[model samples]
Structures are given as structure tokens and as C-alpha cells.
Target chain A: MKAKHQRLVLALFALAGVAGAGVLAASALRDEAAYFRTPVEIRDGKASVGEPMRLGGMVAANSIRRQSDGLTINFVATDGKASVPVEFKGIVPDLFAEESGMVADGRLRGDGTFVADRILAKHDERYMPPQMGEMPKNMKAPATT
Target chain B: MHAYANPTRFLAIAKPLTPWLLGVGLLLLLVGGWAGLTQVPGDYKQGETARILYVHVPAAWLGMGGWTALAVAGLVQLVWRHPLSGIAARAIAVPGMLFTALCLATGSIWGRPTWGTWWEWDGRMTSMLVLLFLYAGFIALTNGDEGQRQGGALSRGAAIYAIVGAINIPIINRSVVWWNSLHQGPSITLRGSSIDGALLWPLGLTLLGFSLLFGAMVLMRMRRIIADNRVAARLRRLADDEGI
Candidate 1:
């Protein structure tokens, strides 16, 4: 094998090395690479507009207000310290709800409302699930005020 | 490229080059590893899970990258009957396939804490999974029959697959942003990009290291291909003369 041909191959592969790095770096820079934010993180204005974020907070008492439109409903979710108003414009799950501990996902609307597309009902220690284990140290819910 | 078709000759030369390539690969890997592990900070939002980004992001980066290398190499071998290219393709296959698997796995693990689920059938995640299957298919095609190992045929199949896969890659990548889905929107993008510099540098370096590691491995595998060819040809010639 000629040294020249070998050199050419080496150079080409090396160039590919550079190209791969460029693609990764470029995407990471764009934040196209996503990671999720928790309730605390979401409240800090940490999630991007389209980035799917999960927030868990309690349903503020009497904050549930269903609109006449049937689909669009307004609810306020709070972590006690801060509260974010949410608007859901879709068929909510039967368990759909509000409270500091309920988690929701979707885009935060321009009107400072969390336009939730999905909702999750959380369970605490006293409310043990059938398949779930006993509450772990970290998952032990915060004492209710 | 044909000049180095002889395995022994390729070996003699590549053997010398091996140490140097290996050294460089290691250096880049370590440097990138160090940079990613040390330099990147906890995310302003995710806290510690943000640390996973340095590793998870690059793993995904290299996953796509390794396939591109294999598919391209296959194309070259098919078009030109370049034995070296075939070896390069095969050599890259394992690494590429492994990284793709790693990317998907890591992405899911990252998803659990953030998305609250271990899996989602979102466009990006699903497409990346398909890419992993493609890599496996290429590996399966190359194994077993030496007759099936013709550099031309093997590569042609791979090349076709690669090109098709590349088209899907962008669609998978853009799926979260393009359509309403559970996946997170791109934090890093073409313009108006916004990520902390602390995260970017290390993440970038990790990618460099991963790419370098791939090149070094490809070069090593090419040398092995040359050796196998030499032995295979000699055996064939002896059998022909005996006419047994």
C-alpha cells in the first residue's frame, strides 16, 4: 500500500472527527439537547418555551375555574412561596386537578398562564400505591402548612 | 488506496501509525472527559441532572456521527471496490453502533428525572432508536459468510442505509420543535443560541474526544482487514493450484 493513499484515508477520517464534534457542539449550543426541570426549577423561569417541563405544586384552594368553552379551564398551582396560574384548553384526565403537589406540562402562555397539555396526580406517603414501594427518604412529602 | 490493499504491507505501515493514533485518541478522550466532568456546572434549572448533559449530549452526538462514518465508508467501498474502505466501515460499525445505543439509553435516563417517564414515543427519541436498529443491521450483514464480505456488496447496502438514515436524523432532531410533543425544545440551535459557556466548552471537548476515538479505531480496523485479505488470497491460490 502506498504511504500516500494511507495518509489520505487518515486525513479524511480525521476530518470526520472534526465534523462530528462540530455537529454535537452546535446542537448543544442551541439547547436542542433538552433536560427536564422540576417544580422549583420551573418556578425559577428556567425552562425554555417549548422545552417540556414538569412542575409539581399544590392546587390552590378554590382556584379551579372551568370556562364555558368546555375545553379551556383556568386553575392556579402553587408551591406555597410562589404561584403560577395555569390554563388547560384540552380534555383533561379524570384525575386532572390543582394543588402545590400536582405536576403539569406544556407551554407557559404569553399571558403568564401555564397552558398545560398534560396533568399528573401525585400520591404521597400516607396515600400508598399498590405497586409502588414505601416512600423513600427524598420522596417523603414536605409537611403540609 | 489499492496500493495498500496487501494486508502485510498495510500492517507494516499501520502498525507504526497505530501507537501515534492511539496516543492522540487517548489524549483527546481524556481532555474531553476532564473538561466535561470538571468544567460544566449544574444547570440553573436542573441542578445536578444538568451534569448529565455533558455525557448524554455527546454520546448522542457521537451516536449519529459513528453511523455517518460507517454508511459513508460503505458507499466508498461499493463504488470503488476499495478494500480499505470496507475495513474502515466494519471497524467503525461496532463503535458507531455502541455509541448509538449509549445515546438512546442515556437520553432515556435523563428523561426519567425531567420528563417523569423512562420512555416517550416522541419523534426525536423514536427516530434515534431507529438509527440504532440500522447500525445493528449493518453489523449483522457483515458477520458470518466471508463470501458475503465482498467490500463492494457490503458497503453498497450500508451506503444506501446510511443516506436514508441521515435524512431521518434531521427530522428526528427537529421533531420536538416542529410538532407538539412531550420532548423538550432545543436549548441549543442554529441561531439565538443560549447555553452557559461553562457547559458548552466541556460538552464540545467531549464531542471532539469521541470523534477522535472513532478515527483511531477505524484506522486500527483497516489494518486488520489488510491482514485478513493477505491470508485469504494465499489460501485461495494454493487451493486453485492443487485443483483437489
Candidate 2:
């Protein structure tokens, strides 16, 4: 009987674990699932609102703007196929983060600015770039923050 | 077959490596965490939230890695009948479930700023969830019976389930690819690497740490299990001899 009870406890724990996993999976999909889409995807009514998501593309070269609050910045992120204007209310990411495979998070407000909460940049494809530039004596990565 | 089943011999070899394994596991995990947390640059986009990747990605990797290891361990136990394999299998489950859960949780956290929803039935997520269920199922099946007859056999079940789950893991991972779906394509290296240096280095370090940690923890737990079994058998024998 005690052993049977032990089995019950293990099963309950397993169930609880599954429940926990399910909860997390659901939430992840809700929050992170957006950035997976293409420009056509968001335009094709595939984007979901009322939850967070990642939006990735090139920041259209000259479309960036800083709002009056000084923290809110707006820009257009595009896949070259289609473009989505993005608005972010935080410190700007690395300068190189733009015009490359830049990622943004937030939402498309009614006014059409994507209110971004986060930004990510992808690495370059060249595995071994020529370390051509002379290094400064105390060089560090340039900061845009 | 019984040659390796001798717990005494197994203990002789295992005891020496225990501390070393623990030490290495600790060292790697600590260093990995620091590298992931401090050295890695913040996401140009996500800000501080991207820090979760150090934990989340490694957890996801380990979750998958644990089950894969279990599947193999299960096979060994079933075929080789290594008395320790069952212990190994059982040991793997706890961390397997833990890492899988971590993966799911971290993925959700990453989603909030990206997906705009807390949850979705994405293919990769669903399959990983299924893996979690499989881990739970394995634990339940093994832990169900008491006497040697009913469900006493776990390695056999575990091996079978692990293989089955192993076969399914890919299916789950690729389900979105085969079919046009809402799920995101692979975010990591599958498509020539998407993660930046700020993220990848930490992820790589943490993954190494977690793998080492899994090795150490599984070994420690398996040794303890084997020792307990000996104690149990001894107690039973004494009870029978004394007619208690």
C-alpha cells in the first residue's frame, strides 16, 4: 500500500511536471512566436496582437526617428519584400544592429508604429573576416546604448 | 551477464570518479554561467530579457540531450543487463524533466516580447512538450510497481519508450518544416546560425556545463541507487534467514 502511494505521488508529480511544461510552452508560443514570421506573414494577417513577439528584418536605411521623450525611437524594419514600421521605447541597440538582420519586439499600434520592447542583431555570415583594421590601444566594441 | 552485475566491483570503479565528476561539473557550470550572464552582450533588441538565453537554450539542449542519453542508456540496460543501467535511466529522468521544463519556460519568457502571446501550439514546442510527457510517463511506469513482478522491469520499458520517443523527437522538431505552419523555423544553427556572439557564446558554454553536470549527477545518483539495492537485498536475505 505504501508503495502504491509512492506510485501515486510519482504520477502526480509527473502530471504536475507536464502541466508545468504545457504552461511554459503555451506562454512561449504566445510571447516569442511572432519573430518567426516573414514580411508576407505579418501582412497576410498572420501576426497576433495582445501578446509579445519577435520581429526581425533589416531596419530600412534612413527611416529611423527619435521621439520627443528621447527614449522612444521609431524605425522601419523590412525584409526588402515588405516593410513594417517599428517604434521602440528603450535604449537603442548596437548601431550595427540596424540595416542588418535586426530584430525588434513589441506591437503594431493603431497608428502603425510597432511599439518595440526589445531588439536583436544577427551575426555576419563570414566565418573569418579579415582582421584588417588596426586595433586601437584600448579598443572596445562601439556602444549605441 | 552477472559478471558486471556485481555491485562491489561497480562501486570500486565509481567511487573514485564521483568527486572528480562533481568538481568538473561545478567548475564548468559556474564559469559557464558567468560567461553567459556577464560576458555576453545584451541583445541589441531584447535588452536584459535576452539574458534568459543562457539558461533557456542550455536547458532546451539538455532536455533533448537527457532523453537521448536515456534512450541509449535504456538500450544498454535492456541488452547488456548492466545492473547499473536502470539506475542510470532513473537518474536521467529527473534532470531530463527539469531541463525540458526549463526549455519550455524560457521559451515562453522569450515569447512575451516577441510572439505577443504567452502560448501557442507550435510544432517544436508541442513535440518538446510530448518529450516531457514521455519522461513523466517513463518515471511513472518505473515507479509504479513494488514487487519484482508487476512493473519491476523499468529498463525494458524505458528503452522501448526512449527509442519510440527518440524517433518522435525529430518528427516533432521537423513537423513544422514538412508542413506549412505557424511555428518558427530553427532559430539557432540549423539555418547557418542566427544567434549573435552575444548570445551564442553563452549558450555554448552553458550547454557544455549542463552536459557535464548531467554526467556527474547521473553517475552519483546511479551509484547511490546501486548501493541501496545491495542494502535492500541484504536486508531481505537476513530477514528470510531469521524467519522474520
Candidate 3:
């Protein structure tokens, strides 16, 4: 075949392959795009249940419970405004603890429970979380004693 | 683009720019590394591990950016059949693959202490791995010994591969958001960065430094390839004169 004709044929084949792969990828991403939401959003009915999503908040203090199976655990994640109960069947991340920020990826059940398949703990670039007990001087009340 | 297609003109610009870029890049990289290691405070949760972000983010940016550059060059080669465009794409592959590998290694190291595992088959990690494999395939196909086969057909074939492989670049970028990934969501956005201002400064510097380094490497490689091609053509002409 002439070189020009051969080049045209090759170009056409390449374009067709790219188009086909793009279509496949777009369809795959549609089901995979999981949006993130906080417990407050879940409490306010702003987040949809039964869809894959991420829940981000702090682990509520004294709310973690482990079952006899050892692998199953339950905890409550709170954002100071609201909270969501989370259930998981695997080992929690080493850094997961009460009052620490975390995110869980899974589907929310109709019963208002989040069943997480995976959990990720978030860390801030500071030596300590802003001293939780210290109220700023601006927010302190005038002496009433 | 055609205005700079002439090799002599391109070299005139690139020759002086290469050393300046390399010097600035090395200086900024040292400063950025110093700030990340000493000046930035340790994380409340992650402690010193957070500093890895300084190196990791820049590497990841270049990994994706390099492929984008390759795709653009490939597009030019295909549409205009411009001679230098293939050289640009060829120059990009080696360093681009190196950065992708670096990103993956740093991410794994960071993940070990933070996530309690060295690797996870999550969307973001998996897609980046695929990008690295695509780079390897392109390098092998383009640079492999083809004894006496002309560069035209091979370069056109490689350009097609480069363009096709570009489909992975976006997927790597969006993987964390598009799937339930262990990797965190993007910390930097057009409006602002989620990272603290102090840390962001070092990260921005490192990203600029790495990009400059990438540019310098590509220019250097293209220059060497051009020189090599000239010598080979001269040898071929000499052989023809000998009537063998």
C-alpha cells in the first residue's frame, strides 16, 4: 500500500481505540465516584443513605465497642454538632482514637448506621491538637465570682 | 509552534535556558527539603511523617504533568508531523517514569506509619501504578534496538501509544475522589489549599523546583539525541561513499 494510505489507516485505528477506552472508563467511574459528607450532614438528611460515601468526623469519646469476635467493632463519629454510629469488621487503623479526626468509606444503612469497609485517620501538621480544654481569652466571660 | 521547529533556533533558546533552570531548581529543592525537615512543625496526628508531603506531592504532580506533556507533544507530531515533537516526547519518557516511581515509593513509605500498611490496592495507588507501567511500555517500544529500521515509523507508532496512554492521567488525578480510596482527597484546590499556610509555602516551592528540573532534563536529552542522530547520518553517508 502507498505510504499515505497506510498512515491514514493507522491513524483511524488509533482514534477508534482511544474512543472505545474512554467510553469504558467513563462508565466505570460513574459507579465509583463516592462523595464525602460529615455526620452533621447525615443528621440533617443532606446525605443519601445506601450509596457509597465517605463519613468524616472525630471518634466520639467513650463510644467504641468491640465484639467477642475481636474483628467486629462499633464506634460513634461526631463533629461536635452531631454523630453517626459506625460498624466495621476489620482492624481499625493504629491512630484511630476518641476525639481524633477520621474518615470511613462505606454505605449508610436505612437504620442510620454507617457500615464502613475501610477507615482512614486524619492528622494535622501540629505537635498537638489545639489544647481542647483551653478557652480563648476573647471567649471568656467577665468575672462573675 | 512551527516558528520554533527549526533545530538551530530551538537549540539557541534551550542551550542557555538549561543551565539556569537546573541551577535554580537545585537551589530551591534544597531549601524546600530543609524547610520540610526542620522548619515545619510535626503533625498533631502524624508527627514527622507529614513532612513527606513536601516531597510526595511534588513528585506526584510531575508524574501526571509529564504524561500531559508527552501527550501534547504526541498530538503535535501526529497532526503537523513536526520533527522536533517526537524528540520532545522521547526526552520526556525517562524522567517522567522516574518521577512516577518516586511518587509511589514515597507514598508507600508515608502510608506505612500513617495507615499501618505499606501498600493497599486502592483506586489512587492502583491507577498510578498503571501509569508507571504505561511509561515503561512506551520507553521500551520507542527506544528498543530495531537494527536499521528508520525512525519515522517507530516514532509514529510511539506517538500513538503516548496519546492513547494519556487516558490514564485523568484517572490517576480523580481516583481518590472517584472511588472509596485510602488516599486522602486533594489538599490543594484552585480557590485555596487545605494545608496550613506554613506547609503550603514549602510545597509550592518544591513543585516549582521539580517542574523546572523536569524541563531541564528534557532539553538536555533532546540535545543529546539530536547530536547522536547527526553522527549516525554522517557514518551512513561515509559507508555509501565507500561503495560497499
Candidate 4:
């Protein structure tokens, strides 16, 4: 091969090597790469009890119930097909509400309830101006507290 | 490619083009900023916070786009030994770093009220952070003595690093989809955009403006580098004549 062709081959090989390494590394760290687990993942026994992990899903409709103490609140996180009850003892994020996406950092209890230390609101990609009026039926309006 | 190989020829085109690009880019930016800030209604959910999208989205696009340019330049420098390619790569670094930093800062600010956190180690955020670090490392490597000389060993190493670092771009783009992330998935895709037309138009305008501005800045920096190199070459000849 000409010198130019040789260099091209070398570059291609280097790229392939880097890509292969990336694929291997990503696959190996799959567990760590996932920021949170869905209710379905937990239900499928992907998560172990008492091991600290994050649970992410939508807050089921009417699932939010505040305890008398006011700091502690209970809600069920659902991915439609499966649901996991979650408990948190702090002021929730402003966007956190029934039917909105949330990611809770905590652990699954032996009783199956997830005890959360932190709660983060996860908004979807859609962006519509308020002047447009009512959101599409499939999309839920964020609850105003 | 050969036409641009001559620095004077390249400068002739770049010098005249830079001002036009900058002028049009700034005008578009002003219009986009006005429309995004005052003309459009607040988001149905995020309210006024969504206006940040105009600046943040453009910065994020250019941040990734800049690196893609660097990688392509690096590839040309390595394979073809193009004299101008190395200058182009060096010129891209600072602006690329600035855009990446801008993206991170804006994202963090947006995250505070929206995500209820200032930062997260989620896949999307983490990968973007990695991109920032990669830019930093590339800048440092290229600025060393090797980079000062055209096509030096360290410059080639920098080129290789640029090629390797490109791996992160795709990772950053796909992070929200490939992993669970606090950051949202892509709003605009090959399929279509989820953002409303009212909001999307300003975003489009800003994206184009920022991209043009980025191109102008890169050309200006390349011209500056070329001029500095010429002056340095003249000074070296003068020193040799003086036997110093």
C-alpha cells in the first residue's frame, strides 16, 4: 500500500480500537452508568434490599400523602407497568407532584418501600408556550402547589 | 485544500469574511434574544425559566460542534500534513472551551429551579463535564512548545488526543437516552421537534447566529496565529543575521 493508504489504515484501526474500548467500558459499567432504576427494574429483582440506589419514575396520580409531621411524605412511583411506594422526609422540589417524573435517591426496604434521602424533579422534553392553552391530552399539566 | 495551504491566500478570504460573519451573527443574535425574551409566552410548565433555552441550547450545540471541527482538523493535519490544519485546530480550542463552560454553567443554573438541584452526576451531565475536561487537556497539550511549532511531535500527539477525545461527543449526545439521567432526552430529533413553533424559531435563529459567530472567531484566531508565526520567523532571521 502507498504511504497515504498506510496512514489511512492506521487511523481507521486507531478509531476502531477506541470505539471498541468505549463499547466494552460502557457495557462493563452499565450498572453504574444508569443514574436510577425504574419501578419495573426493582420489581424484576434488579435491586437488592438496603443497598443504596436511586429510584426514578412518575409520581402516580393521587399517590402523594403528607404525614402529620409535615416534613415526611409518602408517594408511589410508577412506570405504568409497575409501581413502588416511596417515602421522603424533606421539602420536595417545586416541580415534584402527582403525575410528574421524579428520581428519588435512597434504598429499597425489606418491606418493598423505598426510603429516600433526596428527591429530584425530572421534566420531559416538550416545551409549549402557555398562550397555546390546554396541553395535549396525552401530556399532563404540572401541578401548581 | 491546496489553495488554503498558502497562508496569504487563506487570509485574503478570511480577513474579508470575518467582519461579515460577525456583523450578521450579532444582528441575528439580537433579534433572537428579543424574540425569545419578550415576544414568546412563558412555558406552560417552566414559566419564564424556559427562556434560558435560547442561550443554553445554542451554547450546547456549538460546544459539541466545536469539538467535531477540531477532530476533523486534527485528522487532516495527521493524514495530509496540512500546514493550515494545525492552526485551525489551535484556533478552535479556546472558543470551544468557552462554549463548553458556558453550556455547563447555563445548564447548572437551569437545573437549580427546574430539577431542584444545581448539579447531578447523571450520565448526560457527567459526560458533558468530561467533555469540558477533555477540552482543557487538549488546550494544555497544544499550547506547549510542541504546538508552537507547526507539525511537531507534541502537535501530532495533540492531534491524536483530539481524535480520541471525540469519543465523548457521541457519548454526551446519547447519554440521556442510553442511561437514566436527570437531564431530559433530546427535544429535537431526526423525527421532529417537540418544542412549539413559537419557541423553536428563536432557538433556530440563535443557533444559526452562534454558529456563525463561532466560525468568525475561529477564522480571526487562525489569522492572528499565522501573523504571529510570520513575525516570529522574521525575528529569528534578524537574530541569525546579528549572530545572537
lDDT digits (tens) for residues B15-131 of candidate 3: 999999999999899998898788877654566778888889899989999999988777777766777887788889899999999999999999877876688667788889999
lDDT of 2 by residue, A88-126 (tens): 777653433456566565766665456777665443321
How many clashing residue pairs, candidate 3? 1
Please, what is the whole-model Cα lDDT of each candidate in the order they appear?
Answer: 0.62, 0.64, 0.78, 0.88
lDDT of model number 3: 0.78
lDDT of 4 by residue, B81-138 (tens): 7888889989998999999999999999999999999999999889989989999998
Worst 10 residues of 4 chain B by lDDT: B145-154
Per-residue lDDT value at A55 in model 3: 87
For candidate 1, lDDT tens digit of each residue in B1-244? 5797665676787788777777876787688777666655555334465566666777777777777776566556645566566677677777788888888888777766654567765557877888888878877877654633333235345555554455446656676665434555575665533454555666666667677676677767766565566577788789999995
Report backbone clashes per prediction.
23, 31, 1, 0
Residue A90 error, candidate 4, Å? 1.5
lDDT, residue B233, candidate 2: 81
Best by DockQ: 4
lDDT of 2: 0.64
lDDT sort, best first: 4, 3, 2, 1
Residue B169, candidate 3: alpha-carbon lDDT: 81
**lDDT (tens digit, per residue) of candidate 1 on A16-40:** 6655764665456443333223445
Model 4: what TM-score?
0.95
Model 3, residue A17: distance off in Å is 7.7
RMSD of each candidate relative to the true structure: 12.7, 9.8, 7.0, 3.1
